[model samples]
Target: MKTDSTDDPRTDVQTASDPCQTNRDHVEYVGMHVDDRPVVLNLTEHERLAPDRSLDLIRQSRPGFEWGDTGSGSAQLACGLLLDYTDDEAVASQHYIQFRDDVVSQLECSGPANCWHLTGDDIEAALASVTGHEALTPDGGTPTPSLPVNWSAVNRSERTVFQRRDIDHYVVLGEGTEEWLLLLCAQGDRAYPAPLDIRTVPIEEDPAPAVRELVAESNDLVEPEENA
Candidate 1:
């Protein structure tokens, strides 16, 4: 269930010639696929704005979002309201399909719809402002990191942030009965590679506090580093 973060194209820039290749500039995205490639809604512009009540809060700041006729439906899904429980299934199903198609069309018109397509330097600036974690490529999106000096890190070899490997939303995304009705990924999308993994990697959870508790207990949860 847990996919390696390094498998992601955006996070994994390493090559056979450059294993130590550091992540240069990562722009976080909340997107889906179009035409067998990733069609991203680059969220770099809306880094300052929180998705409190509405995804609409950041639509204007997005890199390129074509608010087509079905744009309102996409917005509705993003805000966690697809349809009422009492609403008829046939109508909801039809609406859902149309909304996803509109998103795909809009994405294609926005820019080159590719997974590794970096938006530009402007996005990098926005990322620089919000990336709180030290390790960027694979860990830039990690919500929290333990203090290096903390005792919980006694077992750690290199400085590392806990990778967010848990993803529950995909289960919901695939489920026809889930409250959230946005079909961000199709069945084909899951087979591509690490983009699905990267998208699912949970970024919101903070691991520092729990790790701190283990430190207090003198429990080294991880293998100790070999002495240099």
Candidate 2:
């Protein structure tokens, strides 16, 4: 999930609007609620100077099952893991224990947890880096975009760096005994607004490769615009 990269409340300049309107707006926060749970689209990055083997262990132990597979134990495990990581579940399974051990170890070494929260600037950077389609801030985040994020449709849209519209993927966060364990969604596995369902699963075989493929494909979706 992406982190809230917008202006910190401390630094935001207050404008004279109907304070009542502002107050009312406050109740309508800029996020989505999936299954009655608030889901924010923020990105964060985590780093360790030294490779943590435990993280690798947890990642490896994670079942590489796809979501929506009712007959597979791996699928169930994947769903459970997601719930564990998201703090949706009160008690984690053995797999969660192993996963938590890795996270706790990493946090102990690093001050706080951080992961890449893609912002408009990051999208711009990605567009410039990629070569075709335009990068978009479906929802604005860090370094608030000064301009609108949409672009005119052009020839060869498929070759762009980022594509317009929704995404699809299943995510695995833990191992459990039932279907409730997975994080099911149709949006990209990495972020929310990615719909929530109970049949979420890990990408088949290895999610890492699928994830990498998505990243690369994202680049391809919005490659540089052709010369006018």
Measured by TM-score, the strongest candidate is 1
1-118 in candidate 1: lDDT tens per residue?
A: 4435554433432343333233345433334333333233334433222223233322211333222334433433322211221134433332333332333224322222223322
lDDT of 2 by residue, 154-207 (tens): 223222121222233323233344322333334544565363433333322322
Q: Backbone clashes in each candidate structure, one number apiece?
A: 0, 39
Residue pairs with colliding backbones in model 1 are: none
Task: Report the alpha-carbon TM-score of model 2 versus the true structure.
Answer: 0.17
Q: What is the RMSD, in Å, between candidate 2 and the native fold over all Cα?
A: 20.6
- Candidate 1, superposed: residue stretches over 4 Å from native: 12-50, 53-73, 76-104, 108-228
What's the lDDT of the predicted structure labeled candidate 1?
0.30
Worst 10 residues of 1 by lDDT: 167-176
For candidate 1, what is the TM-score? 0.20
Each model's lDDT: 0.30, 0.28
